[model samples]
Target: MDLERPVQIVWQGPFTLAAAIASSTAPSKGVYQIYGQHIVFGPNSLLYVGMTDGQTFGARLAQHRDRWLVHEDDVTIRLGVVADLDSSARLADIEALTIWWHSPPYNSKNIWTYGGGPLRIQNLGARGRLHPEYSSHWKPARTPPDGEHP
Candidate 1:
């Protein structure tokens, strides 16, 4: 991945699984965001950020629907299709950066440590609650002073 160029993600939809499956433009591999009610963030809050490698967006979202449908909140999904990516690593980098930046309630990993180097992501179209751009870089761990115990 080129650190200089921002990865462009073309976002579409706050759709249900059935709707996404029916859509002609949805991609098979990309990052997705799940939105619904949250105890704290309330209605239409971003609940999770996830990526699909080999599976279609419909299939990936079906899995989430199985898990989330039991709850009372209505689940909606938004797909982020990368407009310029060289490899799957770029896809994972996008997912990691999005999760790290957004800190969605259901996403537990990649909030602290991510494998990729510095990356900048540009979200285009229907971003919803996500930032328009994200620049991800490593942050040094804080160390306590000589007499202090953490």
Candidate 2:
């Protein structure tokens, strides 16, 4: 099954949304390296470094969000494809090095998403990932509780 669920990156005019999805498909299973970071746009305009392969790359970004819904929040999870061995000293390196590189943009936070660390769903309805904890803490004032509104 394809692990990297395709997503669109809504950027400036130079980069069209269609272009991002065409390239963001998940890599094969053998093993891929990456640097992923979470971004929440609200006039702040910042970015993070992230990576993934046939595993968590696609959905994890969606995990680090709020409104549990993709179309609702400003945070967009993105993973930077990092090629080369010695990328990480160990498996833990995945989270360590990547988050380290994008620490400032990540607000000095550590990324919990890693090679099948958790939250792996092999089916559609992927948007169910929209859980309160997965959402960004900084959201609209009266968005209503999880089930109450959405």
Candidate 3:
């Protein structure tokens, strides 16, 4: 989506997996980040970034509880609740941008192919291990084929 205004996300939490799954204050739909030890990235590095549109954060996080609970390095989660725009598409945009910028290892897809127009985002509050601002755009190089004139 072409976002004319910067999307503002107010991040909250560094909650344990159990706490996040039981958090009553967490937003029902938004982006989230998981941080924990990584073999290459070491301890407390961002591991995954995800979003939920139809499910509550508790429900969504609960789905991954088993995997995150297995980590020994104190896995924590952060929730990014969008300020004004709460559309699923906007949530997806925020999720994609966060993943693209951080390159968190657990996120295998959408690393290079977050296909959307230019966007601007402002991160507020406790944004663990994420930049305060992000600007995303994709412009592929184009060359005229066989003697095309400019």
- Give each model's whole-structure lDDT: 0.79, 0.30, 0.78
Q: Count the clashes in each prediction.
A: 0, 15, 0
Query: Which 10 successive residues of model 3 have the least lDDT summed?
Result: 138-147
| Candidate 3 TM-score, C-alpha based | 0.83
lDDT for 16 (candidate 2): 21
Worst 10 residues of 1 by lDDT: 136-145
Model 2 bad stretches (over 4 Å): 1-24, 28-44, 47-56, 65-72, 86-91, 105-150
Query: What residue runs in model 3 are displaced by over 4 Å at the alpha carbon?
Result: 1-4, 138-150
Number of the top TM-score candidate: 1
lDDT of 3 by residue, 1-108 (tens): 455688888888888888888887776778988899888989899999999887788898888876555754778999888888646777777788777777788897
Error of 1 at 142 (Å): 13
lDDT of 1 by residue, 16-126 (tens): 756875666557778988888899999999989999888888777777767764573777878888986678887888898888777787887876656777798889999
Better candidate by lDDT, 1 or 3: 1
Candidates arranged by TM-score, highest first? 1, 3, 2
Better-scoring candidate (TM-score), 2 or 3: 3
| Poorest 10 consecutive residues by lDDT, candidate 2 | 120-129
